[model samples]
Target: MFTTGSVDGTVERKAFFGSMIFETVKQDDGALGITTGVENPVPLVILFLVLTAVLTMIQAIYRGLKQRREQLLEASDS
Candidate 1:
């Protein structure tokens, strides 16, 4: 994809070299558009971080419960 910007009867052009690309432009009429692009990474990174934190918290809770169960079993066996 290629991107360029121009205003009020001006012409702009650009070229991109990659599997995918993004193009944004502003027209004289104050309208804008993103021509092409996919898989924006910033939002994905944020989602990944949130999921990781939740999984870590769940694992910690599970470990705590397991330890408590073992302690109770040992006390009962004695």
Candidate 2:
């Protein structure tokens, strides 16, 4: 993503995909500007998969413990 404001108070914004390689240019008013590059989606996908697996394991453990507690209570009552 890139944003810029002109002397006339008009602001412009843009977004692009792939890597984020940027170049800084010095304008006539001694101001700075940025340029963006490409995008990468592999890391995000892997993170999603790992989080899903962790949540599934936590839910399974919780269910098992709840069932065990119920069985223990039933045995004591009998």
Candidate 3:
């Protein structure tokens, strides 16, 4: 979640990451305003890639086991 508003003369930018909140006040001595959303997207991208790889391996293993089980069942029936 993200939001922005003007507080006094400073522009307050806020973003919520799960339970963590980041605030950036654009005042003369304060920090610069943050982006409306994610600041560093690299970590999220890496995590997505890792999860995708793991799930793919799991799916492949499950399919192989199921196919083998079906083959054995057919053989036993015949």
Candidate 4:
């Protein structure tokens, strides 16, 4: 997919390479579209970062709990 945009609007098209489906895109229900607006991807980027942070936090908590359990078992044995 490639896009060429001007202040007026943007021309967007999608094509599948090395696939027979590429021809279909040019026929009925063509993948060509025109979009007129400024695009903001910041929210999506922030959301991805937030999700990664949450995942890391969860992993850290799980590892800490596992380490504590091992320590408790070792202390009890001694």
1-78 per-residue lDDT for model 2 (tens digits): 233434432333433332234445546686766655435556557777999999999999999999999999999999
Output the lDDT of residue 72, model 2. Answer: 100
Clashes (candidate 4): 0
Candidate 4 residue-wise lDDT, 1-78, digit = tens: 433333223434433222211111122353444433324555556777999999999999999999999999999999
Candidate 3 lDDT, tens digit per residue, 1-78?
A: 223355534343333332233555455665565544566666667778999999999999999999999999999999
List clashing residue pairs in candidate 1: none
What ranges in model 2 sit over 4 Å off? 1-38
- TM-scores of the models, in the order given: 0.50, 0.55, 0.54, 0.50
What lDDT tens digits, residue by residue, belong to model 1 across residues 6-76? 33333334333233445566665766666655434566567779999999999999999999999999999
The 10-residue segment of model 1 with minimum total lDDT is 10-19
Candidate no. 2 TM-score: 0.55
Instruction: Give the distance in Å from residue 42's predicted Cα in candidate 2 to where it truly belongs.
Output: 0.7
Question: What's the CA RMSD for each of the models?
Answer: 8.0, 7.8, 6.6, 11.0
